[model samples]
Target chain A: MSVASQDTTIRTGRVTRALIYLTLLLFALFYLMPLFVMVVNSLKPLHEITSGNMMALPEVWTIEPWRKAWSEAQIGVQATGLKPYFWNSIKMVVPAVFLSTMLGALNGYVLTKWRFRGDTILFGLMLFACFIPFQIVLIPMARVLGIFGLAGTTWGLVLVHLVYGIGFTTLYFRNYYAAFPTELVRAAQIDGAGFFQIFWRILLPSSGPIIVVSVIWQFTNIWNDFLFGASFADFSSQPMTVALNNLVQSSHGVKEYNVHFAAAILAALPTLLVYIVAGRYFVRGLMAGSVKG
Target chain B: MGFLDIDNTTKSYGPVEVLHEIDITVEEGEFLVLVGPSGCGKSTLLNMIAGLEEITSGEIRIKDQVMNGVHPSKRNIAMVFQSYALYPNMTVGQNITFGLEMHGVPKAERDKAMNDVAQLLQIEQLLDRKPGQLSGGQRQRVAMGRALVRNPDVFLFDEPLSNLDAKLRVDMRTEIKKLHHNLGTTIVYVTHDQIEAMTLSTRIAVMNGGYVQQLGTPKEIYDTPSNLFVATFMGSPSMNLIPVKLRVDGEAVVAETESSEGDTLSLSVPNPSARLKSYNGQTVTMGVRPEALTDAEGADHRSTHIEKVLNKVTVTEPAGSDTFVTTTIGGAECVARMRADTEATPEEVTEFAFNMEKAVFFDPKSEDRIV
Candidate 1:
């Protein structure tokens, strides 16, 4: 090639790369706009948030709204903090995530390795559970929980989240384990390892990436869920998301936009923290089935 | 009774039976190889022996103990899989000792066994590496180490070397042979590669279409295959099969075939079996190994009958030491192994010698040897 043509090619390459970066920057800004608004409004005084620009930075950055949102925000008839509700969410989510993830791992192992005659059909039905909308299950779930005397309890919410979240977690683990070599399981059996032994020793240790994906997914789902939390949680056992909704929609003498924004950010912190801590594994888990190691 | 006996064993999936009534008796410390093409039920038989698959009707006995309805772990067998099947998460040392750990062996004893096996397989340097970190050959060694540390009654190999590259496969093949010699454990190995079966087996059971076509020592199977399938499948540049009409001459039986140029060529059969008398005036298949057909100077001098024929060579493939010269006999392709220096060129007429002493005749209708 001539030098001039080579120069042109290099110039075009630079232009294309700059164009790609510019497009990505635009998307980044588009997605981050709501979080930016929430942070900016949460720091501003109530009058500044209500009367001034939503995009403008707070001239007087004070953490008073955050404190009030945490301890003094009025949620429904109660004027107490979102603190108790946050604890409720944690109490419900920890066990729900733990139990659901364990169940999903076992389900994935059995479905892939020790599959029975109708296992494919059973897995298909479990997969179909992931697509069902939450609205369809609310009334029936409420009646079932009521029958079990758990209608308004935190354990009821935990059970609800566990049941609903299992489908997605199982799907994640099942797809990941399907690509795993069955020879390992066979070798384990020949080595005198039984079912649980093979799973615990040979399979579970290699399940790091998928477990992270499932945990993050279930934590996010159970933490941010408001429908079940609102419908099932009593006032004393209301989750953070339900309390956040109540705080935002509750009418008072004047609107507390700063408190509402601060509450929303506070409610979102745990899931965001989970993603930030182990985001690489989440990507690896997503690409597990498509790319074999 | 042999150490491991599979008597009238059959395998079926619902309505379709894949393995017919298989009767194999493997003596203690014998290296028996089951070889066949894909879908020939060799691997299924190996699984049945390992107690991984349920026996359909017959009994599998190991050391005079019945093996039906037993779990694979209880059967005391270790299998090296084609994929190596190393635990991806465990270090090589841990993988080797996992079987011992499962059987509740003491840690000191397990370590001693692991060290011994690692040394035996020359994988001591790879003890700390995970399976993913090791190379293909290293992972295969670790797999063997895992199986060896168990010290099971029988070692089952399911095409274990099939995953390695050509050069590594030969090296591992030799290593496995040496290991078998040193350990002398009874082994039931399955493979589709006939060369592997011939090189490693003390006895070979060649299968086709769910039947054991022939079972014998490597030399016997190579010299006199029971049927046409075993004859064609057991050798490289496989045995050249020519359709020839049999005729009883004054004192000998002769096979009459045609050259590539449609010229008649007659070869006298040496020491004709009584069965050939009945086959006279009918067409039969003459099975001749490529080594049995050579250039005139390369013909075996000890053979009682040698016939020289000139045929047009269709192709000449020189593989280092031997040149495979292809020509047409009875309108079918035949290969002759000649010395590399032979002047056999494609599309040129070349003089070749056929050593009739080692040739076998088969009934074309039954596809079985007419012995």
Candidate 2:
């Protein structure tokens, strides 16, 4: 209405837009800088990598490191290297993700739809178990695995991953299921669907985002785990994470930057591929729990 | 045997008692509505009948067989939820046929049933689409289709129209009534809305505080409420209740209020019982529905024959069909529904005829109807 007021409004709007742009620019840098450095350095030779400025561009780019890492990283037991261990990681993670997702869906369905005495206490215990650190369960879980003669096998790690993964997966599912109306569950019951029938046919079909979330979370956690892999399995059954630790992280090495960098990239590729595939569902699932529909 | 008999049924969750001594016997092909405000145990009662909730203390018999411990799927009942609980992943056809498939119906029969219900609900074109693809009203019809395909002996609807918009709700309400008319299946519906109760129910059970306050046909419940709660709950704009002292003026009973006309309005009740006559000098509550009061001269109804009471109208709300005039009578505010043609200015004293013929008297202490 007035010249001064109109001028102030325009100035304020411009400032707000500028502030938003500045904030986004900073956040993008914060997330992408490390990734950019890793990709660029992975292409550099040892001399170029060790010449001190790690963030600087390479003098020459070559795929030699990737080639060497794959072959020299041994696809067999004698070498304790990347290729064999990577396949082992895949084998271990696939089952863990599948089983964890299925069990999480079941847990969510029961907690939200079924009513019984002490259901609250059971839910509270699950929440409490989620807050319990994995460090506290190591000895007891190892002992249990030893009794089953699965202490050093891939199946043993699968069990461990599933045990730890259920806490988070169930929490994700339980909260998601809470948002669904109880009437839907009742209708399913009246439709003559049994427990497993409802889970597989009715509930699971609509649980797109939650299934993706549980799979991605369990796969990433199992693939990235070094401590559990080292403690639970020996060299033969060891996953890439543990084997990579011996290859790149052992203090006795002469610090083969090329091999270390290449191995790190190789190990991270699975999770990166998973994120690219399930990125949308992961974000949708997270938003569903925290926001109104 | 009755079509569905719930005899002395009760439900309690842990320490919380939700329903008490519920008894409802729905005749074959009858439409029953359970109407009450939230937490009044109407939905719980419906759920118990549907076998969704466990009955704590009595028997539920369906066509002479005990159904108290039976699972919901085995109860021979179909329920339409308030959320229109159509499966999001299944097509409308798949959703409708799911119940029949679970019951081991042959493929041919299931298809025929699905097609029949879809055609009946006029959703044949939308049968291939998922619930998410359809609009709210379409999803509701699909839900109904699912229930109808089951061909259960009884249908239970739990506030099915509460989710729809006002216009959509009206349309669905009529569709449901028409569906009942065609199917001739017994139905037990639950809703907090009184208008739905009045329109959809063949028999309305008004529940309050975990008890059935009154149960009757919609007209009976509306015209002759058993108690103060039913009288107030059944009607829109509610019934106007005014406290007055009953006294004998010569040969007739006179209820006098100083604030209203500053005098007594003498009237007589036919065959007054000893209990009612005992309160001759005591205070009682008189309830008059808004529709009962009109422009004294316009309707020429029996309401005109009673004593003419003069009062000042404070507000006149003209709602298309009728003008709701709020006036002060007997020191209390009373709403009278007049013909839309009636003209009255605010703050002007007007003569409103009283309708004693349909009016009810309540014992002020207990808030129960007095015979």
Give the count of colliding residue pairs in each prediction: 0, 0
Clashing pairs in 2: none
Off by over 4 Å in 1: A1-27, A290-293
Each prediction's RMSD over C-alphas, in Å, is 2.4, 3.4
Model 2 stretches with alpha carbons more than 4 Å out: A1-61, A74-81, A249-256, B247-259, B270-275, B300-306
Q: Name the top lDDT candidate.
A: 1
The sequence of per-residue lDDT tens digits that candidate 2 reaches over residues A9-124 is: 64557788999899999999999998777777778888888776888887898877776666675433344447788888988999988998888878888888885678778878
Q: What is the Å distance of residue B278 in model 1 from its true position?
A: 1.6
Provide the overall lDDT of each model, using Cα atoms, as 2-decimal numbers: 0.92, 0.84
Give per-residue CA lDDT, model 2, range B57-151, as digits (tens): 98999999899879899988999998888888899999999888888899999999888888899999998999989999998999999999888
Error of 1 at B99 (Å): 0.7
| CAPRI docking class of candidate 2 | medium
